[model samples]
Target: MNYMDEHILSLKNKLNYDVASNNVNTSLSQTVISEQDHSVSEKNLALRLGDELIPLELRVILDGEIEVSVPKSFSLMPLEQAKFKYPSEHRPEVIYTSEDGTVNITFNRTESTLANEELPEFVEQMADVLRSVQPIRNWLGTQVIVNHSGLSIGLIRFIAAGVDKNLYNEILLFTHAGQVMMGTFNCMESDMEAWLPVAENTVHSLHAVSLPLQSSLEKGADSL
Candidate 1:
């Protein structure tokens, strides 16, 4: 249930694909999704954060199969800058960066094959890996896997050391097209208080396309 191999090359190619063709209308959550509003509870709470709302845009990604909302001011990271900013040998499938490049949201769908029901287990495994990867990292919090819009989402947050400063990172994992899909939000630790709420709102706004399972579900329903 690991996230499997990095398909960076193919992912980069996919980044060039015209996502605009698959665009859909959507809106981000107006208020922060309450911390207690997760799989453990059926009722989701929306708490108002006094921070000014950031404009958001809804767009499709991962070959136009996933629909989600991100800050409208963010732009796709240019290939050269992605290499420089990330500089890591491994990188996400695609990255959207703030105008100054300090804040970022990333998306990556790995080659790992999986079924919908197995998502929570895999996510737990992934969480274990995250802990192992940075043994001394400051742990923020992790969420119980949640069912949203027919998709299973696992969220984890931590503070990772950046080149010259600390960063607040939140990662959301799910499955699509039989693969594990990852979405992330990160910013300087100084901005965490303001952006973390927005990140939570963004999580609520995401709606993964479930077409791949439709045919099978329909067949089973017919048989029933």
Candidate 2:
């Protein structure tokens, strides 16, 4: 089966939503509760991804364990530690990749405390770690503070190109619910024009949501 088909099947099993498959187009549709009301609305369609609105049909399974939009052309997979190595305690939670593997979005999370450090300090430390892996050729840093859908987030954006002239990376760091989250977008330098907007939108979509009680407990246990 194709990656798209496999992703849809995984969503079906995970979310139990109404999904229809067709050779030409596959779609997922569901009625969700509006934030303003306790009543369910049929037209309350589309999932909110940061400031962007993604059609329901294009959304993959998003629950509390991890939340992010899955664009039609991308497939979501669990991070395999054996495949990628990083020096920090922060680890990749999930990854979204295009069919050709030329583009990738990685979601990572790490724990932090007020007593240990602040956001700016954490960003600098993380930046050093990233630079250590691959020397950065050019870098730009910015801060994003947004409050939307009752969620307020402060993020640090790092735009860097590595020594390899062919690749570019955009990494965002933020803290939510006592955990630091990083969203990294990497793509060919040639494809930046077409993929950068998508990557930014995905990064802005990060928010704090409750994971399944059992899943939360299991993660806590593993950390012990």
Candidate 3:
């Protein structure tokens, strides 16, 4: 089966979502993680999220990991990882399905930086489970949290909103390396809004997001 088909199946089995083959299609990985330790030139490519064309730069590490970095200005949305060949030692990309159906894809390459031929059976199963959610709509918003360590490190938690005409933008959180926590979406109109309900001070090294007055109205309008 193709990557899209396999991913759908995996999602159905894992998340209990009855996704059909026609409902899901394989798309490119939104974020690519390359390792700087490797001896490969940087590759520049364009990434499409909904309708936006994002400029992507990938640096391949000697061991087999791909270093990924996106522009600070553009909002990062959830994406599906496509099939590609790389060194074998590299850990296959991963996807997480939240209780509310938010999909998070993680390309774990802390180990070696090699891309193996085709994805292993295990990784394929994980992808299927991850994409089972109904795609995010223009008016909807989702809170995303990312954890990273090692040579490259960062923790990002932000509210992603398809604010205008499917144009998504992300409010910055404590987007730094090491351990970090932050919150962004606090409005009532979001499609599936939830928060990390812990003490604010305990978020010692946390990123805090402000709910501007204008943003409140925008969110309200999007919901309508």
Candidate 4:
């Protein structure tokens, strides 16, 4: 079978297993899940990414400390969600991709806060990393301030072109609550203009909510 069909089958098997284990009588339908019926906790902050009624999937990590909302048009994979590597630890929180596979978005969080002044150096390091993997055609990086969900956020926008003629764009942001978010969008050089804005808006829609330590502990206990 093709990859898409295999992916859909895998998702169905997972959902069926979850339902059977949970003893929930809900019927399993299509692989794509609706936003309203997502399984994430209600305590998590809501993030709206444009008005598109695209099918979405939700992923929670770090004992509900981090949440990610991804469109079903893209494939989703859960990651370890840890900064430092330990045995059996996954690095990224989640990953998404567009239907064509040329576009990709990765969502990750670090425990430490990222300072605005340090972004340029970080981008430089990233640029070096990208060059090591692929030949670079051009690179640009800039910082911007964004207001979303009543929070003033420091954002870094990085754009580059690889010798393969693919365009890459990434948005890095840090929250006052000491959470770092990174979203990378990639597409063909010719399609960059049309897809860049959509990627940027998706990044902008990311929202962080802070819960008291006691509340977090209580929630974790309840889940167990």
Candidate closest to the true structure, highest lDDT: 1
- Taking the tens digit of each residue's C-alpha lDDT, what string does model 2 give over 62-166? 244445544554676434531443223333455566554545666655433321135555545454554454434555554544533333343433333433444
Instruction: Residues 100-184, candidate 3: write the lDDT tens digits.
Output: 2222222331211212222233233333333334243332232223323222122222222222312121221222222111122
Clashes of each: 0, 0, 21, 1
Model 1 stretches with alpha carbons more than 4 Å out? 1-54, 210-224
Taking every candidate in turn, the Cα RMSD to the unseen true structure, in Å, is 9.1, 14.5, 20.7, 14.8
All candidates: TM-score = 0.67, 0.53, 0.20, 0.50
lDDT ranking, best first: 1, 2, 4, 3
Q: What is the lDDT of residue 95 in candidate 3?
A: 25
3 against 4, candidate with superior lDDT? 4
What is the lDDT of every predicted structure here? 0.60, 0.44, 0.27, 0.43
Q: Please give, for residues 50-112, the per-residue lDDT of candidate 4 as tens digits.
A: 544454444454456544455545675323422222122323445465553445565555444
TM-score of candidate 3 relative to the true fold: 0.20
- Please report how far candidate 4 places residue 209 from its true position, in Å: 3.5
Candidate 2 residue spans exceeding 4 A from truth: 1-63, 78-91, 114-117, 128-133, 147-165, 210-224
